[model samples]
Target: MIISVRVQQILLLLTLLVIGISREIIQLELWALPLALLSGLVLQGIGDSKRRRKWNIASVTISCLSLCLLLRTQNPYVLFYAIFFTVLSKFLIVYKGQHFFNPTNFGIVVCLTVFPNLSWVSPGQWGNYFFPSLALSVIGVLVARNAQRLLTAFSFLSFYSLMLLTRYLYLGDPLSIFTHQLKSFSLVIFCFFMITDPRTTPRSFKGQILYTFLIALTGYLLQFHFYIREGLFYALFFICLLNPLINKLFPAKEYQWAKKI
Candidate 1:
């Protein structure tokens, strides 16, 4: 039962991604989705062979779907390149056998930076549908809890909220403005799903808390100080470079999906 936790998460995310298409939550064309999926799967399969490892279709599927959700590309070639690089990053970039940056995030960041006009992120595309937002939050919390990374998720959110509050008071922003920002769909998806990725995050409880706080701080600064809309993704991308150092300073057992089951 415990081992099925990740499988559950994949299924849930896949369902949501598909539903997002039908419900117009994700405004991507039909062809782009298939192209991205094929690109991710094919690249991962070839990469796995080079390393002489068996394929993990589940992980590849999740990565592909996640990229589709976050990256908005009108060109099929652009989508393919985004997913192709995302899959390749896992094999090409490594530290002590673990990929530092989240694969989906790495791909999204690269596309947005390299092809600003071609590929973009619509952070507010998910919109503020009350019931769907509540449902996603609840399921995300459950998945994070099952994965035993709830501490990271909670800490990031708590620190992020506190920072937002402080900024509101300092700027004399309207209470309504503060309330609206807190209800952001992007923040919900990021805190619960993206940042809580057990593989890329710290192994120790203390380390996880510290890592999440710093990510929150960096994201806050980027968003407010620099006015970078993709601040949260960039924060995680740069902070991931410190994963090895964090593991060395606060050593803990590496998390394994199979063992958890």
Candidate 2:
């Protein structure tokens, strides 16, 4: 039987989570995962109830998994608050009919900003495990293919790589520095999963290319110029504010989880 894209996403994220746990990449309290998951589901359920819409367990699962992976916090209450706001943001932060900021990114950013001491984003937490990086890349390609957002993913990575290379040449950085930066596990995940998020991206192919390119350029500036640690996330967050105008200029079709591009 053919699997739904939502199911595919759920499976892929779950697989990544398991691998992360096994490799000790995800070091959190035993209760963190369950608490975060429960919070996401319950909040989402309430949101759906108020909106008189059907509950989507897949969305809840995906958001929670993303939180568990990206966010590192010792406080269960902090995780719960983040997940709670994550679900709540979906309902409150609307543009037309869809949410503008990506749910996972928004939640993580908010918590990080508000509770800087208690919460953190472990960009290098995955380390440079070659095998896991390869596996994640393959899975990301598969997911992007099915989602029809492969172009966006490739565009983002290509532009981002070019920026990195340009910086390396200008700074006269060593080849090893370039290699190390390119092999970042967090960068791979961001390219494949977050940037390729169909719902948040522009509809037309040209729009997506331009959009991803802007994100890459801005991210490069933030990272290299200002020395921001979470440059990619912040770049995406700020750029997403202009998505409405981008969609208006290059409108094609809104993405649907049930439909393959």
Global lDDT of each model? 0.83, 0.84
Off by over 4 Å in 1: 1-3, 129-131, 259-261
Q: How do all models score by TM-score?
A: 0.93, 0.95
Q: What is the lDDT of residue 28 in candidate 1?
A: 76
Taking the tens digit of each residue's C-alpha lDDT, what string does model 2 give over 100-207? Answer: 777788888889888999999888888876676777788888766554578887888899989999989989989888878888899888888787777778877778
lDDT of 1 by residue, 184-219 (tens): 877888888788888899888878878998899999
Residue 242 error, candidate 2, Å: 1.1
Residue pairs whose backbone atoms clash in candidate 2: none
Which one is best on lDDT? 2
By summed lDDT, the worst window of 10 consecutive residues in model 1 runs over 141-150
